[model samples]
Target: MTLSVHWRLDPAAEPRRSEPGAWQRLPALARDRRVSTQNRFDYFLQVAQAAAQTAFDGLFVRHRIEADESRIIAAIIARAVPHIHVVPEFPASVGSAVYAAKQATTFQRAAHDRLGWAIAPDAEPAGREAQADFVSDGDLAQRLDEFLTVARGVHRERPFSFKGSYFEVENGGFDAPLNRASFPRVYLQGSGDAALALSGRHADMHLFAPASTEALAKDIARLNALADGRSVAAGLIQPLLVRDERQTAERDARDRPLAPGTLVASYDEAAEILAGFAAIGITELVLEATPTLEEAYRIGQHLLPRLRALTSAARQAA
Candidate 1:
């Protein structure tokens, strides 16, 4: 299996709480507005360029109610940086499946088939209702299933027809240039049985929140069983705070207090941990760090090469 690394991009500036004295500083309203129009596009483009320079395989544009729209950011970055995949996460209920597919088709054509779709899970009750009518989890799963079904159907062939509880299409499909583009890779996140089953049916890659190695191994095994021979790549969304020495790493962790499950270690230890994850079937990793601009280069310069070398040796030994 090949291991691919992707950097997570936040459309708006992320809180710099992890940096020294960041929390103590007063907010700068003038600086905050820099991410508004053209500057926002420049920020995303710069990040994309940095990720590509670091040899990352893709950029994962995050989705959140407070953030700028993910797909638009992704499109802008994708156009500016053509070498890496640009994945945008969004709720499946945002638009008609056929229309979404049409937009995706256009994106694929423009970006040379480098577009990816990470379908965001349903938000909280009020947030969910804001996107679409409130529905049970079971119904939501069914709706997503149908949504992907129609989106993919229209992309692959003409006159595709589908009738589902949440969606219905009659002789609906794309034409000529639209039908010729390849479908975007589908990415789904969650560890529950329902999420696993849904991913097994459709997702090319399934992402899991950071977990203990043993727990992650078990989750991968369960997802594989659910896939029942389908090829569903396993991945993890993790944050990393690595340094040259163990003491420095520990000091940084003490100062930053990162999320639980973030890997805080020396470069060598971090490589070993990530390689261990690869050994257990994690072929993809979406990694993030605070102040993304500098951290992108830091990880790419120090950690990524070590991890790649370790995984390579493991592959050779096997």
Candidate 2:
């Protein structure tokens, strides 16, 4: 299987410190006063251009309450960098399914089918309240299921009708050019049974949190079983820090503990480790690093080539 590598595009500036809650205390007004909108969009464009130039397959624009809206940013970036995919993470609870599908359909036509939908569960209660999304924890999965069902239904077929526990639509769908546009690839994230089941039914890809290779393999197996014959690609979202030398990598790891499931190593070692992950059925990887722009060039120039070579060799042997 071909490996697709995507760089994480976080609109917020890198934090000064990694301590918990360090970045959350500042008010939105305080942060906005520091940077202009044009500058922020410039930064995003530069990152997207770098990722596209570096041979990466896509950019995964992360969702943040404090930052610019993900869908807007994704649309702009996709327009700026037409070669690579731009997958935006948005909560399913944010808007109506039909409306979201209409927006996605327009995006797909404009971007030439490079848009991806990374559907996120509603995690922030206050944000949910602000948006008037009253979906409770118990009904989150059901709501997501109905959301995708209706969204896909309207996008693909005309005169679609659906009545679910959470959503109801009668003869609702697109027409002509709108219906002709391709649907965005759906990506679902989570490790729970409900998450897996939802992905099995709707998602083209299932994203897992960073975990050990063994744990990821087992989870992929479970997802495949849940899919029950449909092909759903397995993916991992992990932080990576690679250096030219082993000692430098070790020191960097000690100095900056980014997150769990982080891979810190020299270029060669990282290639070997990541190649092992591909061998075990990880077809896609979303890797984040500090100062993402520079890291995009770093991984794209050094590590990705090595990993690609290894994966290619393995595939040939198989």
Candidate 3:
């Protein structure tokens, strides 16, 4: 299978969108007068547009604690890049499943089949509990099961209700008939046995963070074995830094002022390393590029073609 690539977007962290005076400070926008509220938004849109024009198969927009990242950009990404899949990482507990399904369906109406979802079981993917005063330490696996069931149930376009440990719906369905394209492709990220089992049941893709090659191989095998024959795609999401020379990339990546644990190597080395992971079942890569837009364009314009060429050559030689 071909490699499926995805780019990450952090509305809260990228310099262009995060700095208070970023709009006036940007080289291109140095003289522009934009409102404070819309400044970050415009910058975010610009980066999103740049990403959409890249060779990436889709995007993975994170959901943060205070900021509703998914909601803030889901509509914009859908309309802006209606061709590629726009996947918003959503917290499983944020809203009721029925409501989420309806909301997603409404979004698909505007963007067609460009809709997809990634579920972060915790309020934060870092395993931090939500800030709610009433509820904490909820059953993540149970919530996921019920959430997916309800989310998929309503999309059948028939009035449906569900009774599960975490959710309840009564003859609930979308007001308008759901488009067949509204049934979203679901992706889940987890490393534990329980989480893998949960994903084996529902997720179309299982997103993994970078780990030692040996440990990751075992996890991949376990995930597939647990799936009981379900075809689940394996993926990785990691920081990417690529350049022409190995030494230059190493020196530059290790010295990057903004990030920790960055990948510093030529695109060829990165592709070769990734091919090892791919051999063990990882077929997708979600790259978190530093300096966001500028670096994203750098990779898209320069590294992607070279990486593809190297991989194709290696495949032919094999």
lDDT of 1 by residue, 1-318 (tens): 789999998665563423233434347653433322344556677788989999999999988877679999899888888789999999887779999999999999999999999998788778887766687766888889999999999888778999999889999899897888999999999879989988999999999999878999999999999997799999999998889998898898888758667888899999999899999999999999877888898898889999999999999999
List candidate 3 stretches off by more than 4 Å: 15-38, 121-130, 257-261, 311-318
Per-residue CA lDDT of candidate 3, range 189-308, in tens?
988888898889989899887776797899899999999889988888878888877888877766756345456778778767777776677788777876888877877776667656
How many steric overlaps are in each model, in order?
0, 0, 0
Model 2 lDDT vs. the true structure? 0.87
- Candidate 2 C-alpha RMSD relative to the actual structure: 5.4
Task: For model 2, state the Cα shift of residue 101 in Å.
Answer: 0.5
Better of 1 and 3 by lDDT: 1
What TM-score do all the candidates reach, one by one?
0.90, 0.90, 0.87
* RMSD, every candidate, angstroms: 4.2, 5.4, 3.3
- Off by more than 4 A, model 1: 13-38
Report model 1's TM-score to 2 decimal places. Answer: 0.90
User: What lDDT would each prediction earn against the true structure?
Assistant: 0.87, 0.87, 0.75
